[model samples]
Target: MTAVEPAGLAAFLAEHPPFEALGPEALDEIAHDAHVERFDDAALIHDGFKEPTDEVFVVVAGQVAVLWNDSRQASSDPDDILGPGDVFGFRAMLTGRSLGPRAVACGAATVARIPASLAGPAFATRSGARFLVETMVPDRRATDVPSYSSVDDLIEREPLLVDPDTTVGEVARWMTDRGVPAVVDLGGGRFGLITDAVLRARVLVDGRSASTPAREIMDTTAPVVHLDDTAAEALMLLLERDAEFLLVTDRAGVLRGVVCPRDFAISPITVGVSLHEQLRRATSIEELATFAGRVPPMLGDLLSRGLGAGRVIAVYSGFLDTIIRRAIGLVFARHPELSVDAFTWLSLGSNGRREAVLSSDVDSAVAFDDAVDAETVPAYRAAFAEVSGVLATAGLSADGHGTTAQAAMFSRTNADWRAAARQWLAAPADHNGAMMTSLLVDGRPIHGDPGLPAVSRVFNDLREHPGTMRLLLRESLAYRAKLRSAWFPARRQETFDIKTHGLLPVVNVARWAALSVGSAVLPTTERLRAASGSAMLPADSAATLIEVFDVLQRLRLRYQIRQYGAGEQPTDVVTLKWLSPLDRSVIAQAVREISAVQRRMDNVSNYVAVEEWASPGRA
Candidate 1:
């Protein structure tokens, strides 16, 4: 017999528990019979038919991923990630049967395996010997294992089914028997699924006859998904399709299964409904104020649901604004003489764009009608001021400009607001208006009727004024991304705030594009797409901006999920040090694209100047 090789197997034995328990002589003997193998990226490490042996494999370098017996048909890299020092094939080695799951090399790597025969007695006598036996002889065989793709896997597949001719009483009994709150009308192909919620909302609540056919209550047009789609993709589809249950169909549209919110949702819709209900139930401003802390947790959940950045912002903005509206209502209820119906409310900056993250500050304004004189305005002012204080007390940080609805300058009538805007446009260039305009440009009505007509007239006047558009564009173009040559080891260290580099550039450009073209959309993602038809932004740049914004928003969301898990609030200040090598590469590419667009914008217009007056040399 040929002599066994020892070094590779000895190393593998050192990492495992039972093998390490063996004395040095036995370990050396085991190593002699070991096989050392190197696998390149995407190379198969083992097959399912390989008989179970007492061999333990230790990953020495790079990574490996385990797959089921159907490795050829179903394989994923990093999907079943194993790192250095991690063991593989142990389950098979202990079981004395065929290896269960197949495994593959994720990258060029070396692995070493030791045979079971070398330590059969040692394994039987090991302290955790039961664990070894359990792993080796898995109760369920690999072939009998459930596949990831299934109707039941995606959704509640056995939903209550009723025949078209079944009486309403029978359908109800079926629901009761199954303990399911819903029933599906299987007679019609497209319109079948009906829920207990639907029963309550439409049947009982509407006083409709339970004897009616389920077709009347069933949502036949609900969207569906394929068994092959991932859980994450299924969740996104739910949001995109705006349906709770996604009807699972095969390639030929054959109804295979269904996926509902419970089937795949990482977060529940009941959370939002509950929060809205709580908001409605609060009778006092103080009670409403205390509920402010709850917003972050809810926003975090919505974001985790893989909801789009724009939709996340929109939904949360609506929810937050509702709280503010209720707070206003409570205040007005207490002060009946305050003429609450006479004014409109505005949410500026991110709140206006519905992009306010968990840490947003309040930027609001109130506009009154001309019916109220300056004297009556005092009561309005006092009421708004008190309300603003209540909001601040409720954890909404005050705006830097103090432009809450409480601010008298921001709180003005339609005629006064237009006059103020026109005067700002007509007056000599000043930093105050430029600074104020940046925030006001992104403003939208949050609590009251949006007096857009008044704001549009001002934008029109500003557009016609020479140097105004230039100034607006310049202001928009002022920020540039800061990139570093960090890939080179000897390069000087540098850090660029991604918020300023990645997020704000798109924000500023989108705002300018919207103002220039009379577009009123607030979110950066929405405004950039809307700007595509605008004459202000180059068509090519508008398209680029949209793609860039989407990428950044995705990056932001990924970062937000990580931060939320760590109990940190979401912000645009993504640290490069925290990102993986792949993410760093993506971020570099995204920044490069954004910078290219910025340079293109600079070439098209000389909107602003970057002159510094510092020391004598700098000056």
Candidate 2:
């Protein structure tokens, strides 16, 4: 009988999974017998041409590149590299195959090469060995992981593929049948894509030949996603390539699957009725609020689904609008005196964009009928206050500062609202006017009445005041973007609070653009396009602003989800430590761009000072 001598190897294997899951005695025996090997970059550790090794190679350091073929027909990136504690090189050993795909190191790396004589028999009998084979085998497939993990992750998928000989008619039919909207032309391995929209407009609408080969009209360079690509990576590809369909392919460049625009499409706020149903089912306001809390998770998932960030805001706002109306309905049903057909429910700021985060305070207002006397107005105000309080009971924080639905100014007649709008526009063109202008610019009628035209006139009034617009831009320029602390000691990772550093700068810049045009639309994207028409925002700034906002929102949404899962609601107050390495870089770029915009605004506003922020400090 041989005695097992295990110490250093046992400690290392014990730290890794599956091996870690193994019983101490088994792990000790396996570790003691494991062979140590080292290889250089692109060095084939194992190949199909050779007999299978009996043991799995557990990566100890550096990187491993698992090649699908020995001929180097295709390759994987270092970004897809696997590291310490990761297991590889056991497939042929498991299947008893004499030949298998080549294996290479991404660089000079050390691995624990377990011999097959001991591993094969142990794997046949030991649970840990079986688990390792099962887990690592599946992980080797590129499709096993999601291309993008979070909403902020860029969307990257390979272009759809088809034979070049395939007819446009057949390609169109295939796209429609598969509901994929696009198909790539594939002969050997590489491909081109033809989108459904393109087929319709270019072939059907343009009266092109149905018999035409798809290769004729197919886009040669469509977006592509590596199996291991993150959501942020995918988005970057989409942005860089300006392509819609993203193909998902394995490390060998062989097509594994695909993701189209619709794969990431987010539905609008139609989920509100179901939420109302859930709310109605609850017996108490607290229960209703708890149910309402479910909305954020749904929104988070939708945002993850590739819903445009602006539309994400719209969808969230839509539900908020529904909840508010539903609350009013519930109030009217219980108290008849609360009934009034003349009031308009308005949302301010983020709510106006329909993009409120999970932990958001509901900022709103109610404009009442003008025919009512002062005595009647008091009663109406009281009734509306009760309604606002009811919303507070249901997870929404009331604007306790009385700037929103709680304020009488918000609950006024059309005439009254018009008068206030005039006052805001008429106010001295300074910080006071800037604040009022900011709120009013974003104020969109969320519920009740078709009086939006009257409200839009306020922006129209402001447009005539160049002084006011300049003042707004001046106020916007008052704050510099936040930076990480410069004095942090070495060894700490440096990251920025994306919300404060990345988002606010864009928000302020976009606000200036929207206010410059008196564009009442609250969405950054929408206002950006609109602001472009009037040259309110520079064309370069407009484009960068959209991308910056998209990145920030996605990061914020994912962070919110992480917090929510940990029994914490999401907040705008983000700490730098929460961001990913990719995100932190993107955020830094956005902040610098924003600062440039602020500098430009400085020239326009004559304001030299802005808010001070820390430099990128060590985390």
lDDT of every predicted structure (CA atoms)? 0.63, 0.60
Give lDDT for model 2: 0.60
Per-residue lDDT of model 1, residues 13-78, tens digit only: 666655665677887886766677788898877754464555667676788877644444443433
RMSD of each: 20.1, 18.7
lDDT of 1 at 396: 71
Residue 171's lDDT within candidate 1 is 72
| Tens-digit per-residue lDDT, 1-619, candidate 2 | 1222457777877787546655678767777777777777788776643556566777877788665434442545422466888766555565455334455778788778777665543333223322432343221332223422532232333334577878888887777676555556464557676776578777888889999888778776766667654443343334334455567666567766655422332111123324534554455556666777777676656555545554555556666765676676666566676555657777876787656766667877666656656566667676667777778776777765676664665667777777767766766453355676666666777556647426546766555665565566667666677565542336434544555566766777777676565566677776776666333346676787787778778777777777887878677766556665676666667777777766755553343222111011111
In model 2, which regions exceed 4 Å deviation?
1-273, 276-287, 303-311, 429-431, 487-500, 533-536, 604-619
**What TM-score fits each model?**
0.53, 0.52
Once all C-alphas are superposed, what RMSD does model 1 give against the true structure? Answer: 20.1
Span of ten consecutive residues with least summed lDDT in model 1: 610-619
Worst 10 residues of 2 by lDDT: 610-619
What is the total number of backbone clashes in candidate 1? 8
